[model samples]
Target: MNIVVVGGGLAGAHAVQELREQGYPGDITLLGEERHLPYERPPLSKGLLLGTEEVQSIFVHDQEWYADQQVDLRVGTSVTALDLDRGRVHVGDHPIAYDRLLLATGAEPRRLPILDALEVPVLCLRTLDDATALKSHLAGRVLIVGAGWIGLEVAAAARRAGADVTVLDTAALPLLAVLGVELAALFADLHREHGVDLRLETSVVEADGSTVTLSDGTRLNPDVVVAGIGATPRDTLAARAGLATGNGVLVDARLRTLDPHVYAAGDVANHDHPTLGRLRVEHWDNAIEQGKHAARAMLGDDQPYDRLPYFFTDQYDLGMEYVGHVGPDGYDEVVVRGDRERRILTAFWVRNDRVVAGMHLNDWDAMDSIRQVVGSPRSQAQETTARP
Candidate 1:
């Protein structure tokens, strides 16, 4: 059987590797729009932006490895259309037929509508080219729009690079969407302690050249501006092809789309999760794990992709990790270990005596236990917290 995987991001690359490892000896084609080899994206904002690692080191595998796996790797090729009935994908002037196809077309950064008015260069660290440009543009003062993970990460990197970093967010606290108010407030303090001038509950009204005007009528001039508001899943391809789509391309628990022959994984897929219901995760771990699961399902070994979602962000010497969905309704019980003042603690979200979600800050040991609790159907109320 011939399989074609579109988009050479983490999910697409992992799917190709997993398919080969699963002993699928048929023709496999990996198509990438980028001219460079498939590389890790997380580091683009962290290590690469900080100049700690070389760009070439981020690749999952070298060119020689692709040849060894006998997978046809097509770089710099854009998939124009997907002919579902014919089982063919159009790439510019060429077309490739496949028995099965995996759509892993990740996400793109949400650009500012007033980007054209900005006089100074605004950096976005989504791709290799973005990182390269942002790295070169780093200067005296760096203004970061949005206080999300990507924005905070870039702020951390730019701060480390000797740039006076300022982060602005419309929410009351940074990461409020994910960590709730209490936890997000602590995160806000962490950034402030690290010299990040974080402006909360603030909106960017406009940008003129090097100056950004706030909704409150405050203006700040910076050498560079980086916007990491968030990402929108690249679902146009799937939506255009008549596939089910909501916030992202809708897929079943097995990672198969409405079309049996077509499947999706990674950031672009809004999977019907076993526990959480429907979710479209953009984390690195989810992309890799889901890609493997989709490949396994494609090989007739159907298995539900129900792994606990986990993600981490490095900011100012703190390793912050989170597991499960921290819904917006707030947690019933919050358990804390260590001191939030010291920036070392693990906050557990309990609902009905069960640990539904957890956020770990500089607490790696608690991750496995937290994962176990999230994975099992154990109630938080069942376990008593021993006083120290």
Candidate 2:
């Protein structure tokens, strides 16, 4: 049996590695769009951009691992079309037949319509090349659009590179749409302390050369601008193959597509969670777990991907680990424990008295205890206000 995994990102690479480790004697082939082997991307804007870590530290595995494990790792080759009926993927001129196919096609950075007209390069950190290009503009004036994780991390890196950094977000608070206002305030505070000119309720109106005019009529001259806006799922191949897609490739609980022969995981897959309903997670932990989960499901295991969504972020001296799911509307109220001033606390979002999601701001020891009762109803004692 031949297994073909598309998009040689962390998820696809882990899927192949897990399949081989689990005693699958089938021939495995992994395809990546980039020349580099499968590498972890989280560090690209953080330690890697800051020059704190080397390139070798970010790779999923060395080049020799593919040959030793009998896995064909094809780099710089793209799978443009998926022929579902014939069980084959169109890779350039040739079509590779597969018994089972895993679509780990990752997401691409979303670009603003104004970027096309701009003479200066407006970057987004998604792949290694994107990071490398953005790295060259370091130590210059950086006008970062969006105040999300990518934007904040890039701002942090740029500041470390001695660049004049200014972050602009249309939201009244940073991460307002995702983490809500209070936590967003905490992150905003962290950046402000680190000498970042954090601008909120700001929108990009026009981009001419290196000058970006804001909606408030404020013109700023930045050597380079980065739009850390979000990502769109790379699901054109799956759609061409007639697979269901919403925000991403829609898959059932087992990470199986409408066609049994095809499966998708990671950022490209909008998985239907047991508790969270249909949601697409674009974090590291989900990619690793879902890839393994999808591979197990393909190998005859029927257990659903029931693990609660988890994500973490680090900026300056602040570190956060958030677990559980927070819906689009967000929770009713936030409860805090410990001290925000001391930077050791846990914040929980209560919806109808049940703790839907919880985040620890510098408190590393509370992860296990927080995970135990994350979905459970919160009591009155746990509703006290604490600092961050």
Candidate 3:
């Protein structure tokens, strides 16, 4: 059987690795739109942008590894059309037949229309080229629109590079979507402490030349403006091919699409998580796990992908690892323990007397203990005893 995988990101690379490790005797074709091999994106916003990480270290697999494994790695090529009836994917004029197809197409950064009229380079951090271009202009006055993960990380990196950084957000604090108000406030304090000019509940209204007009009529002349609002799943290709899609390509717990011959993983797949119900995660760990899960599922493994959601982030002196699944407004109670002033703390979101999610800040050792009580009691009484 010949297997074809779309995208060349971490998910696609991991999926192929899983297939080969499972001893599948199929001919694997990994098609990438870029010339570079599959690379981890987390480093793009963090280490890569900061000039601390080398470009060669970011790749998922070396080019020599692909050639040695006898995997057909097609770079700088894209699948224009896919015909499910004929089990064929068209790369421009060329058609490739596949017995099994995996859509690991990742998401793209949401772009703003205001950048088009601006003379100064408006940046977005998503790809390798984006990080490279952003780093070059880091010495200037950087105005960041959207105080989300990527935006905040960029601010930290730019500040480290001696750039005057100003962050604007529509929300009250950074990471408000995923973190609680208290934790979000902590992050806001973190940035403020680090000399970031953070303007909360603010947005860009107009951009003319080097000056960007804010909603509050505050005009600022910044050399570089970055739009790091968020990312939107690259599900258009799958949706155009008539696959079921919502926030992402809808898939079952086993990572199987509606069509038995097809599957999706990574950021593009809206998985029906066992605990979280239908959700699409855009983090690195989810991509790696789901990619392998989908690969195994394609090989007739009956195991379901039910691993707990987890992700990590790094900014300035703060490092965090969080686990579990809780919507923005889902939790009923929040309990924070340890020295919040020292930055060694753990915050637990409790719902129905059970811990739905927990975050460990600075104290990485608390992760294991935090996991034990995630699905169990997380009340003030329990939190009093289980303070990590």
Candidate 4:
């Protein structure tokens, strides 16, 4: 069988590797829009931005490895169209036929609409090129829009690089969606303690050249501006190809799309999560694991992808980890393992006396225990006592 995997991010790279390792002797073609080989993205904001990690070290596999695996790598080529009925993908002037296809397009960074209006140079941290540019332009004051994980990470990197850093967010507390109010407040304080100028409940009305005007009419001159709001999945290609699309390319428990021959995985897939029901994860671990599972399913394995989703972020000395799913609403109680002031906190969202979701900050032990509890069906009391 011939397999074609599009978008050479972590998911695409992992899928191709898994397929070859599983003894798939068929022709495998990995198409990537980026000129660089597949590389890890998690380091873009943390290590690379801070100059602790080299760009060449990010690739999970080297060029020699791909050749050894007998996988054809097509770099710097964009898949413009998908001919579902014809079983072919169009890349510029070339069209490649495939017996099966994997969509691992990943996600693109979200940009502010008025990004051009900001007279000062602005940067994003989605790609290696973006990180390189931002790193080189860190000699002056930097202002970041949004206090999410990426924004905070960039802020940390800039501060370490001796640049005056400021972060602004419209929400009353940054990280509200992930950590909730109580924990988010603690994170806000963490930034302030590190000498970061953080403005909460503040909206950017206009940005021009060297100044950003806030809704409160406060103007600040900055040399660089960064918008790390978040990302949206690249689902248009799959949707246009007539596959089910909702939030992301919809898939079943087996990671198979409506069309059995086509599969979607990684950040671009909205699969039926085992414990959480249906959800889409943008986590780095989820992308690698899910991509491997999808490749297994393509090899005719009856196994269903049901791994517990996990994600972690590094900000200064803090290591934040999150596991499981907690809806925006519906939580009866919150269990805190350590006080926020101590700089070690783990909060569990308890519903119906069961730990539904959790977040950890510097609480490594709690993070390990929570990961196990989230995977198993157990009451909060039992899980709490089981933890040492």
Candidate 5:
């Protein structure tokens, strides 16, 4: 059976790797738009930006590993069109036939219209190239628009580099939608204490070269500008092929799309989770797990994929690991253990008196305990007593 995977990111690479590991001795082809091999993106903003992590360490596998695995890895190739009816994907009129296909197209950064309209080059953090370019722009004064995870991480990295950092966000606090007011306040304080000029409920109204005007009549000339707003799933190929598409390509519990011959994983798959319903995750853990699940599904596995959403971040002295799902207003109350002032604590998001999600800030050994409480279908009162 000939299998074709589109995407060179973590998910696509892992999916193909899983296929070979599972002892699938059929033809396998992996195509990626980028010239580089499949690489992890988290280091791009953290150690890579800070000049601590080497560029070679970011790749998932060495260049020779692909050849050793007998995988036809094609880099710098774009899948221009998907012909689902013919089971072929066209690369600029060159068609490759496949018996089964996986679309791990990942996502692209959401462009900032103000910067685009002003014809100002604003750096974004999504790929390796972006991070390499941003490292050079991390000096002098850096103005960041958006206080999401990416934006805040960039701010932390810039401040550590001794750059005069100013962060503007329309939300009241960073990660307001993910963490409620109480937890969000912690991040706000963290950045402020690090000497970041964080401006909440503010936005860039106008810009003339390096001088930018804010909504509150504040004008400042910054040496560099960065847009770390968010990203949109790259599902245009699936949508054009008449596959079900929403925020991402709609897939069932097994990562199988409506067409039995095709599947999707990673950031591009909006999975119909058994317990959580339809949702799409853009985290590194999700990409790794979902890619393996998709590979098994393509190999005729019947089990469902229902792993909880997990993500982590490292900003200066603060390191965090969060598991499960809870929107800003999704939880009724947040239960805390340990001291928040000392930055060593584990917080649980309770909904209907049950622990739905949990997170730890600077608490290294709390993940196992957080996972136990979050994975169990127990009451919050009972879970609270079971501390790490």
Candidate 6:
């Protein structure tokens, strides 16, 4: 069987790798828009921006591995269209037929209109090339919009590099919608203590060159401006092809689209998770595991992909690991353990008196305990030693 995987990011790369490891002796073609081989993106904002990680360390596998595996790795290629009826995808005018196809197209950063209208370039951290460009401008003053994950990580990197960092957000606190005001307060305090000029309930009203006007009538001339607002899935190919799409390409629990021959993983797939309802995860762990899961599904595995959503981040001295799903207004109360003032704590999101999600900051050996608490009945979780 011939398999074609689009998007040369972490998901696509892993999907191809899994197929080969599963002993599928078939034709595999991996298409990537970027010129570089498939690479992990987490370091783009963390270690790469901090100048602690080498560029070569980010790649999934070397060119030799692809050649040895007999996988056709095509970089600097774009899938112009998906012809589901013909079981093929178009690269410009050329059509590549496939018995099975995977769309790990990932996502693109949401662009801001004010930044787009400016004469000077407003930076974003989505690709490796983006991180390379932003690293040079980390000195002097850096103004960042959005206090989400990307924005906060960038602020941490900039401050560590000796730049005066200012973060603006429309929400009352960073990650307010995801973590709620309770946990969001921790992040707000973390950044502020690190000397970040965090402006909440603020937005850019106008901009020209490097000068920006805020909603509160404050003007500042920053050396660099960045937008970490968030991202939207790149599901245009799937949508135009008549595949079901909502926030992303709609897929079943097994990561298979309506068409059995077509599948999607990573940030571009809005999976119908069994217990968590519908979720579109855009984290590094999801990309890796979902890709591998989709590969097994392609090989006729009947198991549903039901792993809990997991993500980790490092900012300044605090490192955190979060597991399970907790949407806005999803949980009733947050149970805290350890000392919040010491910055080492584990917090559990409880809904109906049951733990639905949990996270830990600077608590290294609590992941196994966290996984036990999340997705468990309160009585069952209480039996674990790591109870909140």
lDDT (Cα atoms) of all candidates against the true structure: 0.85, 0.88, 0.88, 0.85, 0.90, 0.91
Q: Tens digits of per-residue lDDT for model 6 on 17-136?
A: 999999999999999999999999999999999999999999999999999999999999999999999998899999999999999999999989887656655899999999999998
Q: Candidate 4 overall Cα lDDT vs. reference?
A: 0.85
Q: Which stretches of candidate 5 lie over 4 Å from their true place?
A: 117-120, 327-329, 375-388
- Best by lDDT, which number? 6
Candidate 4 residues lying further than 4 Å off, grouped into runs, are: 375-388
Q: What TM-score, computed on C-alpha atoms, does each candidate reach? A: 0.95, 0.97, 0.97, 0.95, 0.97, 0.97
List model 1 lDDT by residue over 53-100, tens digit each: 998899989999999999899999999999999999999768899999
Clashing pairs for model 5 are none
Residue 333's lDDT within candidate 6 is: 82
After superposition, the stretches of candidate 1 with alpha carbons farther than 4 Å from their true spots are 328-330, 375-388
- RMSD for each of the candidates: 2.0, 1.8, 1.6, 2.0, 1.6, 1.5
Write model 2 residue lDDT over 36-82, tens digit each, in one string.
99999889988889898888899999999999899999999988788
lDDT of 6 at 190: 94
Of candidate 2, the 10-residue stretch with the lowest lDDT total is 379-388
> Candidate 4: which pairs clash?
119-208, 119-209, 120-209
TM-score of 5: 0.97
Please state the error at residue 45 of candidate 5 in Å: 0.7
Model 2 lDDT, full chain set: 0.88
Q: Please list the residue runs of candidate 2 whose C-alpha ends up more than 4 Å from where it truly belongs after superposition.
A: 380-388
Q: Mind sharing the TM-score for model 6?
A: 0.97
Question: Which 10-residue window in model 4 sums to the lowest lDDT?
Answer: 379-388
